[model samples]
Target chain A: MKKLSILVGVVVIVFGIALAMSFKSELCPYVTVSYVVSKGEVRNVQVNGTIVPNSTKILPNNTLMFNLSDGRTEMRVIYHGILSHYQEGIPAVVVGSYYNGIFHAREVLLKCPSKYKVAEENYSTSKVLSKG
Target chain B: MDIGYAFLVCSMLGILASIASSIAYLRGNDTRKIVKRANFAILTFTLLSFFTLLYYFLVRDFSVRYVFLYSDTHLPLVYTISAVWAGREGSLLLWLLYLSIFIVLSTRRLDKVTAFANAIMCIVAAFFNFLLLTSSNPFVRLSFHPPEGYGLNPLLRTPEMAIHPPAIFLGYAGMTVPFAFAIAATYYREEWVKRARNYLLVAWAFLGFGILLGAWWAYKTLGWGGYWGWDPVENSSLLPWLTASALLHGVIVEERKRGMKLLNYALAVVTFDLVILATFITRSGIISSVHAFARNKEAYAYMVLIALSLLLGFVVYIKRKDFFKCYHSYRLRERLIQGSVLIFALSTVTVLVGTLTPLLMHASVTRSFYRHIEIPLGTALVVLLGVCVVAYRESILRKSVLYSLAAGTLAGIVCFALTKLSLASLGVGIFVFSLAGVIQGYSSRKIDLRRAGAIAAHLGLILLFIGVMGSWMYESSYTNINMGVGQSVHAGDYTLKLNGFREVNGNAKFDVVAYVSVYRDGKLVGVLHPKLIIYNLMRSDRIVASVDIISLPLEDIYIAMGGVTPQGVASFEFYVVPLVSFVWIGSILIIAGGILAALQRREEKTRKGVVDAEGEG
Candidate 1:
C-alpha cells in the first residue's frame, strides 16, 4: 500500500509540474494600454478596455481600426475580422500582439449588455438560518 | 412574489427538519414517520415555489425581479417558460426542484442506509433552497411594477439555449443521488455500488446530451463557423462526464472480479465533486468565459458546497478504508479495464488543468494547447477502449491488436492519398483500429442487450472522433469572398453564385438575407438564404450573422453573410466541413446506449433474484 501510494504521488507531482511548465510557456499576459505603451512591444497579450467613442473607423482595405483605452492611456487597435458582438461603449477583451504602435487583435470578446441586471441581495443565508 | 419566497423558506425548513429526523432515526429512534412527512413537505413546497415562479413568467409579471429581468412580453410562451431558469437565482430554484423530486423518490423505501442518504440529500437540497431564499432570490419584488420587462439576450433566444440549462441542471441534480449513496454506503458496508449504478448512467447520459446540445447551438449561432471553441466553460461541463464514463468502466470491472471496489467509490466521489467544480467554474466570473453568469462574492457559495462534498468524501474514505477491498492477481481483462480508467483520469486531469490555468497563472490557455493534449490522449483512449473491449476473449489479444494496427496503417495510406496530410492519415488509422476492435468484440460476444448497447456506444465513439478529426484537420474554408449582384466564386469543386440580396422587416427585428445559389459540377444543388439579423430593441442594433448549412454526402457546405455595405458589395465566408453529421448521430447513439445498458442491469438483477429464491427453496 505504501509503495502504491508513493508511486501515485510521484506521478501526480511530475504531471502537475509538466502541465504548469507548458501553461507558463503558453501564457498570454493580460496587459493594460499603459503597460503596452511602456513595455514597447509584447507578443500574445490580452487587453480589456472600452473603445474610445467615435474612434472606430474602417480602413481602406476594409480592416477595422479603433482606439482602446484603459481610462488613462489609449492604444490604436486593428482587427481584420467582422465584429458581430461588438457594441460601442461596452468593454471588450482584445487578444493579440502589440507592435509598430498598433495592437493587432487576433480575437476580440464582447457582449451586448442587457438593460436590466440580475438583482443582488445583501442579506446572508446563514444569518437567516441562525435567526430561524 | 411573496408567496414564492414563502414556499422557498418552507422547503428549506422542511429539508432541515428531514435531516434532523433522519439523524434521530439513525440513532435508534422511531423518527421515520417525521422523516417521511418532512420529505413530503419538501416536495410540496419546492413544487409550489417552482410553479409560483413559473406563474410569474407566464403572466409577464415585471414586479417579480427575476421575471422582470429575463422575460419579455414579446417572447414566445416556450421561451417564457425557459426564462424561468435563465438567471442564477431561478436556475438554483430549478435545481432544487429536481433534487427534491429525486429525494422523495429515493426516500420512498427506508433501509439501514436510507436515513443517512436521505439526510445527505436533504442537506444538498437545503443548500440550494437557502441560496434561493437569501443571496439570489428570484422572488424579491420591486416596490413598484415596471410597465414591461427587459428582453433576454438575443443570442440566447434560440431553441437549444432555451432548454440547455434545464437539462444540464437536471443532470447535476441527478448526480447527487450517487454521491449521497456512495457516502452513505461507507458508514455501514454493503454493495452500495449496485444501488447507485443506474442513477449514474442516467445522469451521465443527461449530461452527455446536454453538452452535445450546447455544441450544436454554438455551431448554429456563434457565427464562428466551428463548434467547440475550447472555452473554459465548455471544458468544465465536460469534466463530470469524463469521471462518470470512467466510473462506468470501473463498475463493470468490480462486478466481474469483485475488485476495484475502492476505485469505483473514489470515482463516484470525484464525479460529484467535479459537478460542483463545474458549477463554480461556470457561474463564477473568476475565469474568463463566454458564458459567465455574474461576478460576485455570492458565487463563492458554490465553493463551500464543493468543500463540503470533498470533506465528506475524504472523511468517509479514511474511516472506511477496510471496507474497500483491494484484490491481487487480476485477470488480463481486469488489467485492461484498469488501463481504461487510467487513461480517463489522464484526460480528466488534462482538461481540469487547462480549465484552471486562467485562475492559477492569470492566463487562459489557447485552443492550440488543448489540441496538443487532447489529440494524443484521445487517440490513446480510443485505442485502449477498443483493446479492452476485445480483451474479454483472452486468447485473441495479440492477434486483435496486430490486426487493428494493420487496419490502421491501411487507413493511413488511403487518407494520405486523399488529403496528403500525414497527421490526418495517422488519425484516420487510429480511428480504424478502434472500430476494428469493437467489431471484433461483437463477433465474439453473444447478442444480448448488454453487448448490443456496448457495441453501439463504441461505434458512436469511433464515428464522433472521426468527425472531430475530419472537421478539424481537413476542413476547407474560403473567406473574404467579396461579391456584388450576379457575382460567382468557385470554392473547391463547388461554385457559389450570389443571386442578389433582399431586406425583410419583421416585427421588432430586421434581416438582410442574401440569396446564394450553390452548384456542384454545373448542376444546381440548392439555394441557401443566409441572413444578418438585427434586433430593433437593441440600442446598438447589433447584427448577428445567421448561418445556413447544406449537408452534402459526408460533409456540409456552410455559408454565412458577413456584412453588406451601402455600395452593394457583400462579404461572405464558405466552409466545407467534412463528416460533421457523424458527431450528432454518434452522440445520440451514446445516449441510447446508456439507457439500454441501465435497463439490462435492472433485468439482470431481477433474474438473479429469482435464481437465488429458487436455490433457497
Candidate 2:
C-alpha cells in the first residue's frame, strides 16, 4: 500500500513537471497580438484585432489580403484559405507569424462581435462581452 | 403585479423555502413536512415563472427585453419558442427551473435520505436563485421598446436547441444529487452511497447526450466537417465529465468492496464543484470561447466562494482516517479498476490544467498542447482497457500474458496493413482488447441488464476509438480551390466539376448555392450543392457556410463553398473522412447503455433498507 502511494506520488510529480516544461518548448501556445508585436517575429502568435471593412480583397489566386487594426496600429494580413466569416469591422484572431511588417496568418478566427453580444448580454447584463 | 415582478417574487420565495427546508432538516423535527412544503413552493413558483416567460416569448412581446433580444416578430414560431434560453439570463433561469423540477421528480419519497438530499439541493437552488435575482434578472424591464428587435443568432436557430441545452442543464443540475449523498455520507451516518448510484448514472447519461447533441449541431451547422475542436468551453464541460466518470467507478468500488470510499466522496464533490468552474470559465470572461458569456466580477466571485466552500468541506471530511482507508485487498480486477480510475483522474487534471491555462498565461492553450497529453495518455488508457479484460480474475500467468501479447501484435499488424498509419494501428490494437472485454461480458449465461449495459457501453467506447483512429489516420486528402463554372479540380482519387450556380433570397438571409458533380475513378458518384448564406441583421451581417456531404457507412465526402466572386468563380474546400459515423453511433450506444443500467431491477429495496438501518446503528 505504501509503495502504491509512492508510485502515485511520483506519477503526479512527473506529470506536473511535463506540464510546466510544455510551456517553454515549441509546444508553447501562441502569444497574443500585443505579445507578438512586443516581441517581433515570434512564430505562432495569436493576435486579436478587427478586420478593416471594405479593405478585404480576394486575389485571383485565392489568397485573402486584408488590413487588421488592434485599435492602435493597422497591420496587413495575408492569409491563404477561405475565411467565410471575415466580414468587415468584425474582430478576428489570427494565428501565425509576423515577418517583414506583414502578418502571415495560418488560421483566421472571425469574432462576429455584436450578434453574439446581444445573446450574452440578455443572459447577464453585468459585464460587456469581450471580443474572442 | 406584472408577470415579470411575479417571477422575481417567486424566485425570492424559493430562496425562503430553501432556507426553511435546511432549518427543518437541521432541527430534525417535522423535517419531511417542511421539506415537502418548501419543495412544492419552489417548484410551483419556478413552473409559473417558466410558463410566464414562455408566454411572453410565444406572444412575441417586444416589451420584454429578453423576448425582444432573442425573438423577432418575423421569426418562425418553433425557433421563437426555443429562443427562451438563447440568452445568458434566460439560460440561468432555465437551469434553476430544471433544478426545481429534478428536485420534485427525484425525491419521490419523504425518507431521511431524501430529506438530507433535499436540504443540500435547496442550498444549490438558493444560490442559483440569488444569481438570477441579482446579476441575471430575467425580468429587467427596458426603458423603451425598439421598432424592431434583434433575432436569435442564425447558428443557434436549429432543432437541436429544443433538446440540447435543456438536457445539458438537467445533467448539470442533477449532479447535486450525488453531491448531496456524498456530503451526507460523510456526516449523516447513513447508507447514502447506495442511493446515489441511480442519480449519478442518470446525470452521467444526460450529460453524455447533451455533449453528443452539441457535437451533432456543430457538424450540421458549423460547416467545418468536424464536431469537437477542444475549445475551452467544451473542455470545461468535459472536465466535470471525466471526474464524474471516475466517480461512477469509485462509488461502485465503495458500494461492494468497502474500498475507495474517500475517493468516491472526493470525486463527487469535485465533479459538482467543477461544474461551477465550467460556469465561471464561460460566464466570467476569464477565457475567450465561441460560446461567450457576459463577464460579471460578482458572479465570478460567487463561483469562487462556492468552490472554496466545497473544497474546505472535502478537507474537513478527509481529516477522519477511516473514510480514506481501503478495507479490501488489491486483487487483479480491483487493481484494473483502480488503475483505470487513476488514469481518468490524471486525464481530468490535464484537461483542467490546460483549460485554466488561459487564465494563468493570458493566452489560449493550443490544440497541440492537448494532443501532447491526449496522444500518450489516451494510448495508455486504450492499452489498459485491453489489459483489464484479458487479465480479469486470472493470476498473472506467463502463458496467458503471452497469449494476450500475441493477440495485440496480430491486431497491430492487421491495422497497419489496412490503414498504413502507425498511431492508428496502435489504437486499433488496443481496441481489440476492449472487444474481447465486451465479448467476455456477454459470453456469460443469462446476462442481466447490469452486465449487458456494461458490455454495450464498453463496446461503444471501442467503436468510438476505432472511428477516431480511422478519421485521424485516413483524412489526408484535402484542398482549397477556386474554379469557374465548367472547370474541374482534382484531389487524389476524386474529381470535382462545377456544374451550375443559383441564388435564393429570404427575408433575413440570402444563399448562394453552387452545384458540383463528384467523380471517383472516372465513375460518377453524386452532385452536391454547397451554399453560403449571408444573414442581414440590424447589428451584424453573419455569413454561414452550409456544407454538402455524401455520408456512407465507411466514409463521408464533405464540400463547403467559401464564396463566389463576381467573375463566376466559386471557391470551395473538399475533404473525405473515414468512419466518422461510428462516433455518433458509439455515443448513442453509451447513452442507451447508461440508461439501461440505471433502470434495471431496483436494488432489492428491503435489503437496502436493512443495510441503511444497520449503518445508522
Q: Residue-wise lDDT of candidate 1 within B364-452, one digit each (tens)?
A: 67777777667766776788877887776668888998888888889989989998988878888988899888887778655656667
TM-score of chain A of each: 0.70, 0.68
Residue B362 displacement in candidate 1 (angstroms)? 2.3
Most accurate candidate by lDDT: 1
RMSD of each: 5.3, 4.2
Q: What's the TM-score of each model vs. the native? A: 0.91, 0.91
Alpha carbon deviation, residue B295, candidate 1 (Å)? 6.0
For model 2, state the Cα shift of residue B14 in Å: 3.8
Local error of candidate 2 at residue B567 (angstroms): 2.2
Q: In model 1, which regions exceed 4 Å deviation? A: A1-21, A85-88, A113-132, B284-286, B289-295, B538-543, B601-603, B606-617
**Looking at candidate 2, what is the lDDT of residue A23?**
46
Model 2's DockQ score: 0.31
TM-score, candidate number 1: 0.91
